[model samples]
Target: MKEKNLLKDSSAYYENNDYYEIFSKAEDGESKVVNYLSKIAKDKIVLDAGCGTGKFLQILEDVSSKYIGIDLSFNQLVKAKIKSRKENSIFVNTNLKDTMLCSDSIDLIVSPWVLGTITDLGDRELCLQDLKRVLKPGGKIILIENEEDSEFETLRGHDKDTRTKDYNNWILNNGFKVMERFNTYFKFDSKDEARKCFLEIYGVEVASRVKSELIEHKIVLFEFVK
Candidate 1:
């Protein structure tokens, strides 16, 4: 499928909390991205933009003084609330382009593979502007996104969205510097498990490519300071 149509198709999967949980569990199987974010979030007021099902909530909650997770999907937030075990955690259902957060309130903002889902440049910029608005002076923003030429791109079957060279340039133009590029993989228990999960998220063509229990993935981290 074309990358432009990717976002539209994602809603069906996202709305189903149970199935979405399977994909989320299979992602970043090593917790490398989560560990990196946890280190910088210590003692700060952290905001998770588009914190689907609270994947990073538990760790972020443990380290940060306060944790806020915001997403447009109410069903995702409901699942997130169940995952959150701390009193400091707050889940809000709102759009990323405009949130009900106060200006200069957040000490750190972590957005995991969220902004890139937005196909429009204008919409992505608005989302960034709102993040900047809530960030305190000298605050930090960490964005984890897919890197091109990896197994993830191959599985997706298209390169028109944020994984393209154009989007890489767009990120740099938006004042985000590349912090690190690392290798991670989806480590499933078995080939059948990997096939079933991939089939659900990416379809039959993508699923057929899963020949091993470990599918290599590449991800890049971009950092911006307010």
Candidate 2:
């Protein structure tokens, strides 16, 4: 696969909620990403852009006064709604590039593993602009993206999302700062389950590399204060 195509392919997989939910369940089983977000998101109005399956909603809802989860996929949103527990939770089927939200409304925005899949640089910029439009002054936007040379990246057979130099440069030029680099893993109940899950989500080529139940994933966190 070409470096650029991997993200597009991965993004398409989310349209199928069944496979996507399974993939989401197997990822970051240790709550590394959630733990990191909890420290920064307390008592704020949080928007989870491209929330998909609401994997982080439970934790995000626990911290935010009001929580909004938006995605372009209604099927994904349907799955997200099932995971929502609090009265403050809202799920919207909307695109990130143009969310019809009030100006200067949100206190924090979380875009996890979502923007890089946009593929078009122009669209990514538009998405950022819209995110800025809704963000309160001094409010923060946090992004979680794949970092280079992870075992997961090797399996994907490409480096676009994982290689941070160019991606990080684009983010920096847009006024975001690197917050941290961390390690997480996709943990499965068994090697057989891992193989089956990877095969369904990543295809046979990538799935063939699943030698164990735990696959190391490295990610970088970016923060923008508007």
Candidate 3:
């Protein structure tokens, strides 16, 4: 599918799909990153860039001093708002590439599995610039990205896979150091949800394989400091 179609369909896809829900549950960095920050960000503000549906924001409200989540998809934000208690957390509908945030305002920014969706190099560069711009001195960035192709997306020929290219080089080129890395699997609730969403996105052959093989996905996690 084209970028235009992607832009148009993303809201509906996020609103009606299990893609974010099941995977967010499966993501290790979602909990691990917050736990790591609990001691550091107890009195500091944190930003969740490209925070689709804000599932993690619910956790951050109890941990971080303040939390802000931003995403481009309105439907996704709506879902986030519903999940969010809106106590100390604010959910905004916005793009990560150009977040309208004050300079040097955030103590930590956790952006997981976001770069692959933003396939364009220029746009990603701009996003990196914004991340640097908004981060306070001594701040850290936690990223959860793919170590390999997303099987369903690969079957569909979509560019939603990560780190076979771009990300590591981008981190190095930007003078940011990756402090740590972790590997984990993106597992689902059951074979049924996996089969349904897989069929919706990848089709019969992939879904059948997933159902039969009990295939859990591979994810790479990173922590960056500037």
Clashing pairs in 3: none
Candidate 3: Cα lDDT at 151: 54
**Candidate 2 structure, TM-score to reference:** 0.91
Report the lDDT tens digits of candidate 1 across residue range 1-226: 4222446534444766365677677778888888887789999999999998888888999999999999888888888899888876788898888997999999999998788777777888999999989999999999888788787777776454545667777888888999988789888889898888777666677888788888888889999999
In order of appearance, the predictions have TM-scores of 0.92, 0.91, 0.77
Tell me the deviation in Å of residue 129 in model 3: 0.7
For candidate 3, lDDT tens digit of each residue in 1-226?
Answer: 2222333345456666656666566556335555654665566698988888776666666678888988887877777778776586888788777898998889988886675556677887898789878998888777766544555334434445444446655655667555555444445667787666566644565556564213434455566675
Tell me the whole-model lDDT of each prediction, alpha carbons only: 0.82, 0.84, 0.65
Please name the candidate that would achieve the greatest lDDT relative to the true structure. 2
Kindly report which residue stretches of model 3 are placed more than 4 angstroms away from their true locations once superposed: 1-19, 29-34, 37-40, 149-163, 203-205, 212-214
Error of 2 at 188 (Å): 0.9
- lDDT tens digits, residues 1-226, model 2? 3222445744455776376677788888788888988888899999999998888898899988999999888888888898888986888888788899999999999998888878788888999999999999999999888777788888776564434557767887889998988889988889888887877766787778789999899888999999
Better candidate number, 2 or 3, judged by lDDT: 2
